[model samples]
Target: MNTSIRRALGTTALTTAALLAASGVASAHVSVNAPSAAQGGYTVLEFRVPTESETASTTAVTVELPGLASARTEPIPGWTATTEKDGGDLVTSVTWTANPGAGVPPGEFQRFVVSAGPLPAQDEVEFPATQTYSDGSVVDWNEATPASGEEPEHPSPTLELAAGSDDTVASAVAAPSSSDSDTTARWLGGIGLVLGALGAALGIGATVRSRRS
Candidate 1:
C-alpha cells in the first residue's frame, strides 16, 4: 500500500472513533435539560429520560428532589404524577407513571417537568432518579458525580445553582424547547451516517489496494 493511502486510512479511523465517543457522551444517561437555577429562588426544571432498553418501554420515572424544597409538577398529558413526602411535609420525591401500553417506546425519550425551589444555596444539587421499564427492569440513575469529572455509568441528573443576581435569576429556568431537542437528535443521526460512510469507503479502498499489490 502507498504511504499516502495508509495515512488517509489512519486519519479516517481516528475521526470515526472520535465521533463515536462523542455520540456516547451525548446520550449516555438520564440528563436534565437547561439544568440551572438560582440560589434561594424558584425555577422550573425538566428531567430528560431516554429509553435505553431495546425490548422494553419506559413505564415510570421517579426523581428524588433535593432536601426540603417546595415543588409542583407540571402536568404531562399521558402520565400521572405523584409526590412522596417525608414526615414533616417536605416533599421528598416525585414519580410519574405512564398509563398501560402508553409508555415511552424504545428509541425515544420523554421529559418530566417540575417547578421546584427556593433552591438550596449550594453550588449544585443532584436529582437521583429511578427509571422503570415495562418488562419490570429498573435503572437507577443515582451515581454521585466523581471528583475526577468522569461520568459514571448511571450518573444522576444535576442542576447547577448560581448565586442569585437580577439577570441570572431571570434566565435560571430556561427549559429546552422541543425544536432544540429535535435539532440535537438530527445532528447526532447525521454524524452516525457520516461515520458509517467513512468506514465503508476506507474498507473498499483497502480492499482495492490489496488486490493491486
Candidate 2:
C-alpha cells in the first residue's frame, strides 16, 4: 500500500480501539439516568453504580439532593434505604446499604430508583454520590467539569433538562426496566468498526487502480 493509504488505515484502527476503551472506563463510574421530566416536574431517577475495585464489593452509596421538594425510594430485596429530610420536611438525600453478603460484587452493577421532584428551575442538575467499598475505602463523585474540557477522575453525575413545562405529568416519568447503557456504547463501537473496515477497503481499491494504470 502507498504511504498515505497505509497511514489512514492505521489511524482508523487506533481510533476505534481508543473509543472502545473509553466506553469501558465510563461504565465503571457512578451515573444517573433521567428518563423524563424537567424543571418543576416530578420524575423517577435511576442511580447506576458499578464496583470498580478488582477485589472489593460495593457496600453502600449515598446520593444528595438539596432543596428537593420530595423523594420516595423503591425497595430492593437485599438492601435497606434511608431517606433524610431537611428542616422543612423536604427530602435531602438517600442512602442505600446492602445486607450481609448482598453487596454488589466486582464486575457487577446495581440500580437504585427514587421518585423525586418538583425539580428546581435550572438547565442542569447534579447528584453527587459517595460510594463505599467492602475494603473500607470511600470514593466521592462530586467534581464539576471545568472550562479546560478535561474530565475529572471522579466526576459527578449531571443531567441536562429541557425547559420547564406545566403540562408535564408525573405519570410520564418512567424508569428503564434495566440499567444497560451498553446499548448505546455498543452502537458506538459498531460504527467504529464499520469506519475502520471502510477505510481499509478504500485504501486497497486505490492501490489496485494505481498498479493497473
Q: Number of the top candidate by lDDT?
A: 2
Question: What is the per-residue lDDT of model 1 for residues 115-183, given as tens digits with 9 covering 90 to 100?
Answer: 876666678888999999999999999998789998788898887877887554444344333455678
Pick the TM-score winner: 2
lDDT of each: 0.83, 0.85
Per-residue lDDT value at 182 in model 2: 55
* Model 2 lDDT at residue 114: 93
Please, what is the TM-score per model?
Answer: 0.70, 0.73
Model 2 misplaced regions, further than 4 Å: 2-10, 166-213
Candidate 2: the clashing residue pairs are: none
What C-alpha lDDT, on a 0 to 100 scale, does residue 123 get in candidate 1? Answer: 80
Backbone clashes in each candidate structure, one number apiece? 0, 0
